[model samples]
Target: MQLSIYSDKNYLPKGMEPVPMLYPFWTEFIPSEKYPWSRLYGKYLEISNSLFKMTSLQEADLVVMPINWRVIRGESWRSKINKEVESLSIEFAEKVANSGKELIIFFAGDCCVEEIPVKNATVFRMAVYRSKRKQNDIIMPSFTEDFVKEYLGGQMSLRHKSEKPVVGFCGLAVKDSWEKKLKTVLFHGAMLTKSLELGVSPYKGQILRSQALEVLAESPSLVNTNFIIKDKTVFLNTQDVEQRQKARAEYVKNIVESDYILSCRGSANYSIRLYEILSCGRIPIFIDTDCVLPDESIIDWKKYCVWIDEKEIPHIAEKVAEFHDNISDQEFLDLQHECRKLWKSRLSAEGFYTNFHHHFSRK
Candidate 1:
């Protein structure tokens, strides 16, 4: 389908030359030359350039307007950018509607439904970082780094099946404190309030790491690193770069060799390890945190991964054992292959946009 991008000249980055409207917004916060997949941003640009078929505004099937949500300066600067994006969204939505074409406002930051215009347009968000008080239009949640293209390079080989099931997890395990307790209570209480409103229990909590550790301790066939809970909260141990790299290497090795890896939420509700596990063709013991995954309407997540609710943390070992016992050796191998295929086709960014275009075009 022919697509047009709408953006004001001043909304772009200061030094960068004019390019596609979505490129800078999407790759604003991504580090340069850090991870192997950091180049995926350029890959995304190539995919968008080919798929969108950039055309004149008057002769296009879809118009994409990117919202600038990255706070480069401070709160005042963020507010200013938000206002500009809001105004631009309204104007572009009206123009696209008048021209009888679809419009999609791509919000490049965390969930802020208020910034989204309540008009004839679809809103695409990078993260569902907040709870929605009410449903507003068709807001699609997409993540920046959820896909696995070439993170492992030549190391992407099929893992051999082991005699005993091996469950693994390696990450920061935060220590419990008054601060953490308060945050947990507040977050879960808000979720509970929202669940009460929707008449459904999502069973979300902040104690995912601790719970996973407990389950791993009880499991007989498991390999795990000794996670010492620190007094202060640490997402990734960055004090010593070499040690951090070593930890990451060990983490990858364990996950790749093991039959299953524990996928639990970190600070965010969603887990990046889930996608990594899928990319490795290993089953993920997913600890659900009321997460809204991309393309959930199209992707049946339960079929490929072992889903465990937050409330069912106590039975995690039992559930994993049951799942392991039920499947035959051949079935297990098939599942591994199936998981890889799922990532290559449905979870990756290229696959996501390809399917997204097809699905929306038909609709």
Candidate 2:
């Protein structure tokens, strides 16, 4: 069942040039690509046609707005997003409303839970709070490269359960300065307040990350910790080429060395590390804080990773050990391969699109 998609560039917000209508068609290739620090993902470019095809609006099963709403909101630094949406998006929705065509929209960013105000539409976004997510709001995985295949020549080594589970993390956790610490505190406070209203846990990303590391570090009997904790954020689009390469190398090494990677939300309610760990064929000790993961209806995410709730942060080490102890050596080896296969078939950009059309055709 191929989903026929129609898109109009006229609906694109001001100053935005039209790109490919479907996200997987354009997002897989960006200038200065850095997910796996390589551009080998171009190979999957051919897979997009298998599930969806472009068509006329009159014949389309889904109508796309062709504008990345996150980009529009980010560019208008001073303009209110609500005003922009009202002026730019309402017309598009109104045009499609009478046509009786279901809309398809794309949003990418951390904490992009803003309402789209379009009825009968399916929205795909990077971050979506499970409590706030509408029925049509689908959470998508962060775009990533197959790290094991890209770097390790497609070879995956299994980490059998020893006496202790080895948990690893290599990214920003400790706040670098007084200002950053204060900002994190304020952010956590806001989340706490929001949690009360939404009836969810109030665990913010950085704090939860720090606490998880501390818990693992203290419990030497339960887990062996291998962490390269950074005070300042790096490995992003940076000016220092050498520093970027070094950070990227360290990040990959950390994941490869450990049996379980500590995957937590960063600035968003979702973690890109979760996808990366899966791509590397390793287990993720995911800290769940009201996150809506992609393909939840079909994929049993907990089967591939060690899932820990926010309230269970203190017992994180024990949980990791228990999960490790429960699985036999053969099962552990098989899980590593299974994790990689899951990412290749369901999480990667090619995998997502190949299987995603079924999600809409059923509707």
Candidate 3:
């Protein structure tokens, strides 16, 4: 599929570099020459370059306007960018429609929805943090990466499981706030938190996560660590850089060794750990908190991992044990291999856009 990119490169703010949406923070640490950060930003810019053929708008199948607007709360550079992008998006949409080509408004922001003027257009966002149903067409929540290189490197030895089943989790266990409780009551639903003036509520995951941690803490087969958070502030044992690195190393090791790792929602309705678990070729005990996965219409998430609802928090141990006991040794190993294959083929950025391009081409 031929995709044309339209952008006001000269008008971009100072210190801003032209890169794809949801660019990883660790890109600075890893030299671009040695290891490229996915296919969109760095040296291995194969996926975007191959799939999206940058050409004149008059002769393109699809037109993409990359918007760097971030919908954050305070009066900052984000707010300034949001305003600039909003106007630019409107202008771009009009031009694309006039040219008789489908427009893709690619937003590198956390906004739930940004309404464009053109009818023949699709909006893509990084974080769909809104509770209400979106008005835009084909909006997707792009996933972020933390340690893709390390996770992929440790995939070979990740198939070996311990003698006994172990469920592991290493992240913040936040508590629900009173405001969130009030909003839940007023809205008559926990998932929709727009009434509370919040993009995404931390309470949705916190409630289930805290309950699961409580139940799993007593279980003999669980290897977990509760990084407690009081009022959104995480309380860790040590703040030293070396200690933090050691802790992260230990966390990854646990995820790689354990039979299943707890994949629960955090600030957003989705968890980055879900992808990391798949990258490591390990099963994820997905705690569904009214979450939406990318390409849900095509991907059968249940077939890949054990899906558990928030209401089933009490019976988590039982559910995991039942799943473990039923599967044969060979089946377990196969599932591990399948997890890695799924990540590389569907979940990763390259795989995602490749599949997305194919899906778009069909339409």
Candidate 4:
């Protein structure tokens, strides 16, 4: 039942910003600013690996590691990651082959999804991508449905395919252009402005659970991005980015005051907000490409919510209006219901762990 999750302090972010009040979880512990394991454990899973040691995966039922420079820290990032990968080489993957233990990697970005030749380790990618296909044999988890169900209560009972004209967005979306000092805000602002014109309810905030809940309440439709991530210290290596706390509050307040939320993939990983939106009892208006969704055979995005092509973002209002006309409140509710069921079965940590256990148990 125990697992090892590798990450560092930036797992949540630091300073002038307000994050979820995640603390005192028996299983949670922040190893260092360079690695944040505290954000994953406690009621989730108790972590016990210090450095990226082969023994960790060899010893535990499963070892979950993030293969990214973001989590790696310092100029030594690439080398450290490769060193660890080499340690878990084919020879290592084989040692734990029959140990009833497994190794799961948190890989969803463009940076580390490339194929790394390793011997014995089993790599599970969180989001789908071409690099994932080349780098490792992808292992899809079973947390999707269950995660949706638990967080989304009554909404899970409704049909979302044809819900009301409500729209909303979950998670964070800071354009960062408003920062007077970080002069590049103008460019980032342009991107945000483009997204807004595309039909996303504009809100200023970081990705916090309550804010996510609030965003959905505002509009029946929702918009999501990678919750938008950057180094706590941006390009200049200073935590000068404006605090998203104000934005979070404003979004929640607006959710209580508005109608639809929009969820879209921001910079990296498909924003978890897609589920969080459904969890809040609203439909997700997702815009993405074939690269990020789960297997098409198992997931029908149109069946649950409106889907727009990544390139078609400017037509967001048109798409939203079209989707709304096609479905009724009952259907929308059903879609929401289906959303919750999907998250519960596939997105939760417990479900992930269970799958990890099964992967090693075989043979």
Using lDDT as the measure, the top candidate is 2
Candidate 1 per-residue C-alpha lDDT over 51-152 given as tens digits, one digit per residue, 9 for 90 to 100: 665556776666665434333211221133345444544665676678877776554332233344346666555335335523323333232343233346
**What is the per-residue lDDT of model 4 for residues 88-199, given as tens digits with 9 covering 90 to 100?**
3334344445555544444333223334444445555444444335434453432222222233242333323423354544333444344622433443454455342121
List the candidates' TM-scores in order: 0.72, 0.86, 0.75, 0.51
Query: What C-alpha lDDT does candidate 2 achieve relative to the native structure?
Result: 0.76
lDDT scores in order: 0.57, 0.76, 0.59, 0.41
Please give, for residues 1-363, the per-residue lDDT of candidate 3 as tens digits.
534444444333444544353123213323345323443234224445655555566666666654443432212212323455456556766766788777666544323333334465666653453444364445353443424455446325545544556777766665557876875564344223322242444356666677787787777664433332333322245668687667667667777657888888764566777887887778889987656666666778887887898789888877777787778888888988888788777777666665667547556
Residues 1-363 of candidate 2: C-alpha lDDT, one tens digit per residue: 578888765666555544333545445334354444234345455666666778887898887877767665542122235456456766887788888898877777654665655677778888788877788888877878778766778788667667778899999885245665666566556545544222222235777899889999999988999999877678885779899888888999999999999999976688999999999999999999888888888889999989999899999999999999899899999999999999888888777777767777656
Order the candidates by lDDT, highest first. Answer: 2, 3, 1, 4
How many clashing pairs in candidate 3? 0
Candidate topping TM-score? 2
Indicate the residue-level lDDT of 249 in model 4: 45
Ranking by TM-score: 2, 3, 1, 4
- Model 2 residue 100 lDDT? 89
Lowest lDDT sum, 10 consecutive residues, model 4, at 16-25
